[model samples]
Target: MEKSRVYFTDMRTTENSNLQKKLARLIRKAGIGNIDFEKKYVAIKIHFGEPGNLSYLRPNYAKTVADTVKDLDGKPFLTDCNTLYVGGRKNALDHIDTAYLNGFSPFSTGCHVIIADGLKGTDEVLVPVSGGKYVKEAKIGRAVMDADVFISLTHFKGHEITGFGGALKNIGMGCGSRAGKMEMHSAGKPYVIQEQCVGCRVCAKSCAHDAISFTDKKANINHSLCAGCGRCIGVCHRDAIKPADDESFDILNQKVAEYTKAVVDKRPCFHISLVVDVSPQCDCHSGNDAAIVPDVGMFASFDPVALDVACADAVNAQPPIQNSQLKEHWNESGDHFHKVGPNTNWKVGIAHAVELGIGTTEYELIRV
Candidate 1:
């Protein structure tokens, strides 16, 4: 197979060109303009950083991307689906509020922020995966599927579950609706955390299958009757419902690639990933650890798989920062992500994507 082109630009800034400007140049050079953006609704998928995580991509980078889209006559909106985990961004209202709090307001990014999933994280569009083994039908957020074009703006970092949360993780897991997220992460059933349950029956009211029952003021889920819609999780205010992360790490990676296919298939898609702050975990966390390695740079590509491989290789090439997490877990010859996160392997997802025809892992990194 022929190699895909992955463009790279270092973080160095001259007196005239800043990081944001460099980002704009990077994407443009990577061929973002090749897509037809005229009068189209473009979804720029992004993470608006959980309330206190300071390592997420800044609004300045988002603004540059949005402005570039506007320059091409496209209507761009900064968007992300609701997360499965309970946090500041669990619902649309809270998600937007958190985005604004994290400085992703319209005034800052030259675009509007839209929570792809509706208020309770139930609004979804059922998208079929053409060559899926793990996910036959993916439940993606409605607004994300509603967009005329798709673009992923990812903050590349070490992830406990996926080894590294790169383009695939950002698009697949990020685009999944509440139930979709449950399916990717687990077997699609949620069990109540008995200690946190007040037996208020708020979850019982939301269950479509009458699977939830209370005994001794603690709610329990009947897996036999449960349909796994995950609505009960959305309605629980006491943080009682916890979605199971039972899928093996490698299986989770493959499911993420399949869901990513559901999101980008039949749509004009592009991706950009920033390898900075190299956080030890996903930005979904309220807190973040120190950089595992020095910032590599920015990468952009039309092929999500190639983009991820290029970014991973760039990080591997950089020496680990002293006293960093990667430094602590340093293995002499293993891949950097595997050294940092022992259980998860990002290559599993990239390889699955290759089998699914997403893109080739073989890439040519062209420096910009």
Candidate 2:
């Protein structure tokens, strides 16, 4: 197999060219110029940081990408699906509000911010893929499916479950609607813990299928009626609702891979990952921890698997910050991320992505 090309640009900036200008030039040199961007609806998928997280990519970089798309005659929009957990981004209205607060507004990025899933998280398009482990079809956001092209502007960082969240993670789990996330993470059975139920009926109000009801001052979940959408779980104030544990960690990884494949199966896709911040956990948390390493820089590729592999390798090659979470496992050599996050096998996602014919793990880094 030919070595996939992964373009890289470090933190150094010339006096005339700022980071944003450098980003635009790097992307052009990375092969985005090959695509016919005229009049196409391009979905620039990204994680608009949860309200309190300060380590997310600034809106300036997004603006550069959006402006470049418009220059090529493509209509671009910054997009992301709602989260499954209760937070500022559980629905379109609140999610958009959070994005704006985090500086991802149309005024900031030169494009509209569309929550891919509609008003509630239920609005989605079911896309089919053969031989999937946990899902036969992925319930992706309608806007994301409607777009003519897909581009991911991802903040590459460590993830608690997947080891690292990169290009594939941004599109796969990030594109999934609330219910779709439930399907990917577990067996799709949500239950109410009686001990934590306060009989507030919040969960009942959020259930679209009338699957939740109150009996004896406690919430009861009717598994037959529940589509496993997980809205009820997020709405419950007492931490009552929970997803069942039928799938193991390994199964979860395979399921995520299948869903990811379903998302970009036949799409004209491009990916860019910012390997800065280098947080120890995902941005889904309300707050970001201290970075575990110095800012590495930016990477882009036509191949998502190769992009992620190169980003991980670049991060591991850096010296772990002395007082950060990476210090916990500095003695382990060769694979620093694995040693720091033993429970997560990020390689599994990349390897599975390759097996699904997404892209190859072997790559050649082209420094810009």
Local accuracy of candidate 1 as per-residue lDDT tens digits, 1-368:
99999999999999999999999999999999999999999999999999989999999999999999999999999999888788899889999999999999999999999989888888899899999998889999999999999999999999999999999999999999888888988965799888899989988888888999999989999999998778887777876897887889999999999999999998899999999999989999998999999999999999999999999988898888988898998867778888878887888899999999999989998999
* Lowest lDDT block of 10, candidate 1: 231-240
Lowest-scoring 10 consecutive residues by lDDT in candidate 2? 231-240
Report the C-alpha displacement of residue 218, candidate 1, in angstroms.
4.1
The number of the candidate with the highest TM-score is 1
In order of appearance, the predictions have TM-scores of: 0.96, 0.92
Stretches > 4 Å off in candidate 2 = 193-213, 224-240
**What is the per-residue lDDT of model 2 for residues 284-312, given as tens digits with 9 covering 90 to 100?**
89998888888999999999889999999
Q: Best lDDT goes to which candidate?
A: 1
Model 2, residue 90: C-alpha shift (Å): 1.2
